[model samples]
Target: MALKTFVKISNISNLSDARYCAGMMVDVLGFNIDPNSSTHVAEDDFKEITEWVAGVKFAGEFHDSSIEQIKEAIKKYPVDYIEIADLDLVEKVGLLGKPLIFRLSITNEEDLSKIKSTLSYLDELTKLVLFHCDNENLFDQIDAQIGFYNGNLKLMKGYGITADVSLGNFPGLALEATEEDRPGFKDYGQIMDVLELIEED
Candidate 1:
């Protein structure tokens, strides 16, 4: 069982990219639903492309959508996961029963405490959390210093992750990279322990 990674297709301007990524065995597909996002995908176009997206799971990557906005998107996309960077909206949306992919940023010791508390709830509410920031080893550092472990919270590396780096306990990586230089895909298995794909290579 290898680790699984997701490709964040911020903009699906090239429809073929989705098909190519899916064919490459990318585990999850992410689409930006925020209307103001530079890479925002139109709802109709998103729905169309999704029809061609087979096998792998897809998520509606929301920036700061309200509960109503999410409810609307779910009708059209009905994705498997809800990917969000807004910590304030977690419980509000998570309570709907859909698994979450939370993007959290922590810069110092104090933030780490908040992270511990957040993960405590996330361990029970969501599928995974992406540790984002300039700190490369933030995830491991926190665990070593605080010995914080939430039995149910799965961890992944975010921020500046690339394919070549070796991930420790963090089995997954979230990436915005596209083009040929992207990390190659990983075939489906049990969600993966320490290996996840970047959707495309």
Candidate 2:
């Protein structure tokens, strides 16, 4: 299936990776600004990289941070959007006037209700959602529930997406990425090879 790819780059700690991803034409770029996260990228570093990259959508990832904290980050290194993992914090930060990416963790069938509620709440707050789980089969089953909702909101599906989601599928395929780490892993790569592959594809 054709999908819109989102590359979550955590702690984009350097310019090399940023430039590569930008030039790669990735659909979405997620930056983990959560200070508590081990891969968290400092605002200054984030600003420096973002300044060089264009024609890409950016997301500020947060986990249970207060509005003020997000505001502080925005003041320094603003994003075109924000991604929140804690479902409960949805309403608190949704009104920031930027779009929201509500990341949800569903372990099994029992978590369906919470997922539904979150989706319902996002009706006017967002257009995208990220579903994650330890089991790939479970994630497929849970993702299937998207059809049950009667809204125009879009669900993000990554390689599992490109130079046809091999890179996008890495973390989820490895099952090592927690909700906190969804901004993506920072294992860097050679940019020219990726550009060539995309050209070939």
| Highest-lDDT candidate | 1
Decoy 2 TM-score against native:
0.71
Tens-digit lDDT track of model 2 for 1-201: 112233444334566666666676655677788866777887777887788988777788887677788878777767888888776677777777788887776766787657667777777777777666665656555545665666766665431322333432222211111232233344444333334454424
Q: What shift in Å separates residue 97 of candidate 1 from its native position after superposition?
A: 3.6
Instruction: Give the alpha-carbon lDDT of every model.
Output: 0.64, 0.61
> 54-101 in candidate 1: lDDT tens per residue?
877877788867878887877777778888888778888887767888
Shift in Å, residue 157, candidate 2: 2.4
Which is the leading candidate under TM-score?
Answer: 1
Could you estimate the TM-score for every candidate?
0.73, 0.71
- Candidate 2 local lDDT, residue 106: 74
Query: Residue 59: error of model 2 in Å?
Result: 1.1
